[model samples]
Target chain A: MPILEVKNLNVSFKTIDGVVQAVNNVSFNVEHGEVLGIVGESGSGKSQSVLAIMGLLASNATVTGSIKFLGQELVGVNTKALNKVRGNKLSIIFQDPMTSLNPYLTIKSQMTEVLMLHKGMSKHDAVIESIRMLDFVGIPEAKERIGLYPHEFSGGMRQRVMIAMALLCRPELLIADEPTTALDVTVQAQILKILRDLQTEFKMSIILITHDMGVVANACDRVNVMYAGQLMESGSLDNIFYEPQHPYTQALLASIPSLEHEVERLATIPGEPPNLLALPDGCVFQGRCHKVHQECKGGDVVVQDFGAGRFMKCNLMQNLTNGINQGITSNVVVN
Target chain B: MEKLLEIKDLKVYFELKRSLLGKKRIVYAVDNVSFDVYKGETLGIVGESGCGKSTLARSLVGLNDITDGNVVFLGKDNLAKADSKRWHALRQEIQFIFQDPVASLNPRMTVAEIIAEPLNVYYPKMKDEEVLAKVLDMMHLVGLSDNQINRYPQEFSGGQCQRIGIARALVLNPKLIICDESVSALDVSIKAQIINLLKDLQKKLSLTVIFISHDLSVVKHICDRVLVMYLGNIMELATKEVIYKNHHHPYTQALLAAVPSANPKVEKHKHVKPLEGELPSPLHPPQGCVFSTRCPLADDGCKSARPELRYMDDGALVACFKA
Candidate 1:
C-alpha cells in the first residue's frame, strides 16, 4: 500500500453565494519516500484537496471520500483525533512563513512546543532537539538564533525554521504548500535543496503543491496536473513532462517560459479557469481544452489507468487510444 | 534607433529617521546606475527584493524622487525638475503597470472610467464620446470584451484586471511604459498572455518599455536588453542572449544559474552554483563590491575595491573585478 492515498475526494463549501465545489473526485496516491507534486493554476483546487486531507479546511467546508494515511481513513475523523495524527505522523508547511509562524512566539518556543506536545519530550530535550533540527536545516548559530522571534529572521531563515519545525516529529508525510513561492529564486533553490536533502535523510514522503512548472520539474518525483477541481493527468515526472497525454497538461507544459527553450509564442489555453460554483456538466477543462470533442461534453470523465502508475482523465486520450487500437491511422497525435 | 532615455549616475536614497537620540540612516535604494534605453526597445531590470530594480524604474517616471542623477528623455533633462503642469504632461507621456492589479486600480471606478481617466486628464478639452471611444478601443486591444467595459476591477479575474491595467496604461498612447512586476502575480498561462500582449502593443505603438521583474525567464522572454542589479548596483547589463548564455559577473551568473528551468533535464542534470546568503542590508552595504559577501569568487581584491561597469570581451557590460 502507498503511504498516503486520496480516493475520489470532494470538497465543497457552503457560502452566501451558494455551494462552491472546490475539489471534485480527485484521486492520487503517494508511495513511501516519494515526492508528489500537485500542479495547478489559481482556483484549480490543488491546495484545497490537500487541505481537506489534513482536516484543515474552514468550518463551512464539506469534505467526503477517503483520505487514507497508512491505511487509516482521515475523513469524518474528529478534530481531536486528527490533531494527534497531524503534527505527529504528518505535518504541513504553508506558503507564507510569516503568516503561518506565530510572531508573538520565539523560534525556540514554537519549535519546542511541537515536540513537547506531539512527542511528549521534556522542555530541555525539546529545546535541544529544536536546535538540532535547525542546525540540520543549515541555519547557522541555531543555538543562539532559537531565542529570536519569527520577525527577526529573514524570509529564507524563517522558512528554514518552519521546515525544521515540520520535521521535528520526523513525520512520515509532509505537505509543503508553495513553500518557496514568496522567496527569491536563489533562496528558493536553497530551500528546495534543503527539502530534498531532508526528504532523503529522513526517508519521508512529501506532497509539494505549487503553481510553477519549473519548481515541479526541479523537486518532484511524480506529478499530477489539476484543472478546475479535477485531476487531468498524473504520472512519473519523466512521463508528465516528455509524454504528457492530456491536452491541458500539454498546454500547461508548453505555456511555461523556459530558459533553455525560446519559443516565439507560448501555447496558451484560450479561456480562464472555470468558476467552481458553476462548473460545466462534463469535463472541467472542456471549456478551455483545445482538443475537446463532443464526447467531452456529454458524459462523466473517468480516469483511465495507463499502467505503471500513470492515469489520465481526458476524452481525447481515450479516443486516441481507441483509434490507435482499431488500426485507424491519422496524422493527429494526442501529445 | 536613437536613445530614448539616458540615465547617468542615478541614485535614490531613503532617509530613515530613528528615535530622537538614535542616529539617522540613509538607505541607498538605487546607487549610481547608468544606462541608455534605446527607442522602441524593452529593457528588463531584474533583481531580488530590495535590489533597487523597482526604485530605478520608478525614478524614471518621477514616482520616486531621485537623490542625485540625470534622467534625459528625448534630449530633455526636465523630468526631475519639472513643475506640476510639466510633470502632468510627462505623466501623460509615461505610464506604469503595477504588480497588484487589484490594489493599483481604484475600487470605485469601472473599467471604462478607469481607462478614460487618463484621456480626460491629458485631453481635457476632448468630448466624453471621444474618450469613451478610445477607452473601448483600448479595452478591445487588450483582449477585454465590450461587455467588460462597465464591470469593476473586483469582478474580473487577475488576468482580466491586468488586461484592464494594460488598457489604462495604453489609453494615453504613452511613449514609455514602466511595468513593475506586472505579470509576477499572475499564473503562468495568464502571464504568457500579458507578456505577449505587451510585446504586441510595443510593436504596434513603437513604445519604449522598462520592464522590472525578479523572474529571469520572464525577463529573458520579453526583454531586448537585460540589466542585473544587486544591492542597489547594476551588476551586469547585456542583451538577452549574452546575459542568458554568456553572463560574466559572478552575481549575474549565479542569478542565471539559480533560476529553476522548466526542463527537467537541465534542472536535474545541470550543476547549479547556488548563491550563498541573502542580500545584505542596503543601509550599510559592504565597503567594496556589494555582492562580495555572497560571491563565490570573492578575494581580498574584490573585498577591498569596487568594480566599475566596463565593456567586456563578450560584448556585455559587467561590474566585477574578477570578470
Candidate 2:
C-alpha cells in the first residue's frame, strides 16, 4: 500500500469577496520510500493541499474529500487524534525556517520539546537524541550548537536544523514545502543531498512541493503538475519530463531556461492565471492553454487514466494519445 | 563593440560596528573589481548572495559610495568624481530596475504617474500631454494595456507590476540599464514573459544592459557575456559560451555544477562533486582567495597568495592559479 493517498481533495477559503477555491479535486499518492514532487506556480493550490493534510489551514477555509495515511482516513478526524499523528508519524518542513521556528526559544528547547511530547522521553534523553539527529543532518558541532537560538545560525544552518527537527521522530512520511527556496544554489544542493540521503537511510516517503522544475527533476521520483487549483497531470518523473501531455505542463517545462542548452527565446504562456473566486465554467487552464479546444470551453474536464500510473485532466487527450505513444517509444529507443 | 562603461579597480567598503575594545572593522563588499560592459550587450553578473554583484551594479549608478575606483561612462565621464549637477544628468542615461517589483513601486502612485516620474524629473519643461504620450508609449512597449495606466500597483499581478517597473526604467531611453535580480522573485512562466520582453526591448532600443542575478540559468539565457564574482572579487569574465562550456575558474565550475539540471537524465548522470562548506563572513574574508576556504583544489599557494585575473588561452579571464 502507498504511504499516503489523497482523493479528490478540495480546499476553499471564505473571504469578504467570496469563496476562493484554492484546491479542486486534487488526487495523488506517495509510495513508500519514494519522493513525490508537486510542481505549480504560486496560487496553484499545491501548498494548500498539503496544508489540508496537516490540518493547518486557516479558520475560514473549508476542506472536503479524503486524505488517507496508512489506510487511515485523516479528514474530519478530531484535533486531539490528528495531533497524535501530526509531528509524530507525519512531519513537515516549511519554506522559511526563520518564521517557522520560534525566535525566543533556543534550539535545544525546541527540539527536546518535540521528543518529550511525542516520545514521552525524559529531558536528558531528548537532548542526546536531538544532538544525534542534528549530527545526522550534517550540522557540525551539534552538541555545542544546540544551545544557540535560531537567529544565531545562518540561512543554510537554520534549514538544516529545520530538517533535523522534522526528522526527530523518524517520520514515515515527510512533507517539505519549498524547503530550499530561500537558500543559495550551493546550499540548496547540499540540503537536497542531505534530504535524499536521509530519506533512503530512514526509508521514509517525501512530498516535495516546489515551483522549480530543476529541483523536481533532481529529487522527485514522480511528479504532479498543478495549474490554478487542479491537477493538470500526474506521472512518473521521466513521463512528466520527457512526455508531458497536458498543455500547461508542456508550457511550464518549455518556459524554464535550461542549463544544458540555450534557446533563443523562452516559450511563455501569456495571460495571468484566472481568479479562483470567479473561475470560468470549464477547464481551469482553458484561458492560458495553447492547445485549448472547443470541448474545453464548457463543461468540466475529468481526469482520464492512461494506465501505468499516468493520469491527466484535459480534453485533448484523445488527439494526443497516439502522438505521445509514438514519442514514448522513440524516447525509449534513445534511452 | 564600443565600450559603454568601464569600471577600474572599483571597491566598496562598509565600516562595521565598533568592537567592545573600540576597534573599527571594515567589510570589503566590492574589493578591486574591474570590468568593461560593451554597448548593445547584456553583460550578466552572477554570484551567490553577498558576493558583491548587486554592489557592483549600485556603484555604477552612484547609489553606493565608491571607496576607491573609477567609473568611466562613455570613456569620458568619470561618474565617481562627477559633481551633483553631472550626477543628475547621468541618472537620465543610467536607470536601474530593482529586484522587488512591488516594493520598488510606490503604492500611492498610478502606473502612468510611476512611469512619468522619471520624465517629470529629467525633462521638467516638457508638457503634461507629451509626458502622458511618452508614458502610454512605454506602457504599450512593455505589453501593459492603456486602460490599466490609472490602476495602482496593487491592482496588477506580479508580472504586470514588473512590466510597469520595466516601463519606468525604459521611459528615459537610458543608454545603460541595470537589472539587479529583477526576475528572481517571479514565477517560471511570468519570468519567461519578462525575459522575452526585455530581450525584445533590448533589440528594439539597442540598449546596453548590466543584468545581475543569482540564477545562472536565467543569466545564461539572456546574457551575451557572463561575469562570475565571489566575495567581492571577479573570479571569471568570459562570453556566455566560454562561461558555460569552457569555464576555467574553480569557483565558476562549482557555481555551474551547483545549478540543478532541468533534465532528469542529465541530473541523474551528473558526476561533478557538489561544492562543500558555506560562504565565510565577508567581515573577515580569507587572506588569499575569497573562495579558497571552500575550493576543492586549494593548496598552500592558493591559501597564501591571491591570484590575479589573467587571460586564458580560450579567451576567458580566470583568477585561479590551479585553473
Q: Score the docking of each candidate (DockQ).
A: 0.81, 0.87
Off by over 4 Å in 1: A318-335, B19-21
Q: Write one digit per residue (lDDT tens) for candidate 1, span A1-335.
A: 89998999999999999899999898889999999999999889999999998899999999989999989999998989999999899999999999999999999988899999998999999999999999999899999999999999999999999999999999999999999999999999999999899988999999999998889989999999988888888988987887777778877877777788797766676768888889888888888776678888878886778777888997664533522323222222221
What is the C-alpha lDDT profile of model 2 across B78-123, one tens digit per residue?
9889878998999999999998999999999999899999999989
Candidate 1 CAPRI grade: high
RMSD of each: 2.4, 2.8
Q: Estimate each model's TM-score.
A: 0.97, 0.97
Q: Candidate 2: give the clashing pairs.
A: none
Distance from true location, Cα of A69 in model 2, Å: 1.6
lDDT of 2 by residue, A1-335 (tens): 99899999999999999999999998888899999999999999999999999999999999999999989899999999999999999999999999999999999999999999999999999999999999999999999999999999999999999999999999999999999999999999999999899988999999999999999999999999998899989999998988887778888888888888877888888888999999998998888876678889889896778877788998874434632654222111000
Model 1: residue B307 alpha-carbon error in angstroms: 0.8
- Given candidate 2, what's the lDDT at residue B308? 97
Shares of reference contacts reproduced by the candidates, in order, are 0.74, 0.80
DockQ of 1: 0.81
Chain B TM-score of every predicted model: 0.97, 0.98
